[model samples]
Target: MKARVHVMLKDGVLDPQGQAVAHALGTLGFQGVGEVRQGKVIDLDLAATDRATAEAQVREMCEKLLANTVIERYDIEIG
Candidate 1:
């Protein structure tokens, strides 16, 4: 099974790194750049036989180590 995990900051959280990227884009002549938020995607090949089990494990990984649950949100897709 393959699992793709996406981790991102929750709404209302300040994203300074994203803001820096936005500013750089604007300086490079990109217009209408409103806001930017950075996130991470983790792709893994698992030995689990089913999507349900992989999904649960990925969710647990995010909650325990991949992300800071206090200010971030994560979603998992299994295939």
Candidate 2:
């Protein structure tokens, strides 16, 4: 099975990297750009055969180490 996790900063969180990217885009002639937020995608290959099991394992991984629960939220997809 394949599990994909998307991790992103929660609202009201400061994102300096995202701000820098927006500024760089404007400087590079990209106009009409609004607020930019950055996130990460993690793709994992799991040994579990059941979709539900894979998802549960991945969710556990996120809660334990992949995401900082204090400032970040995550979504999981299994295939």
Candidate 3:
């Protein structure tokens, strides 16, 4: 199975990096750029064949180490 995790800051959290990028883009003439939130993606290759089990394991990974539960949220995609 293949798994992908998308981690991002929760709304209401300030994102300095995203703001910098947006400002840079505007300077370069990429107009109309609104609020930008930066995020990360983690792709994993797993041997588990059971969809349910794989998803559960991945969720555990997120809860334990992949995401900052207080300020970030994560979504999992399995293929």
**In angstroms, how far off is 38's CA in candidate 1?**
0.5
lDDT preference between candidates 1 and 3, better one: 3
Report, for every candidate in turn, its global Cα lDDT versus the true structure: 0.91, 0.95, 0.95
**Residue-wise C-alpha lDDT for candidate 2, range 1-79, written one tens digit per residue:** 9988999999999999899999999999999999999999999999999998898899899999999999999999889
Off by over 4 Å in 2: none
Which candidate number has the best TM-score?
2
List the candidates' TM-scores in order. 0.95, 0.97, 0.96
Error of 1 at 49 (Å): 1.2
lDDT of 3 by residue, 1-79 (tens): 9999999999998989899999999999997899998999999999999999999999999999999989999999999
lDDT of 1 by residue, 1-79 (tens): 9998898999899999899999999999999999899999999999999878888888888889999999999888899
RMSD of 1: 0.7
Predicted candidate 3, C-alpha RMSD: 0.6
Which residue pairs does candidate 2 place in steric collision? Answer: none
Model 3 segments more than 4 A misplaced: none
How does model 3 score by TM-score? Answer: 0.96
Query: Model 1: number of clashes?
Result: 0
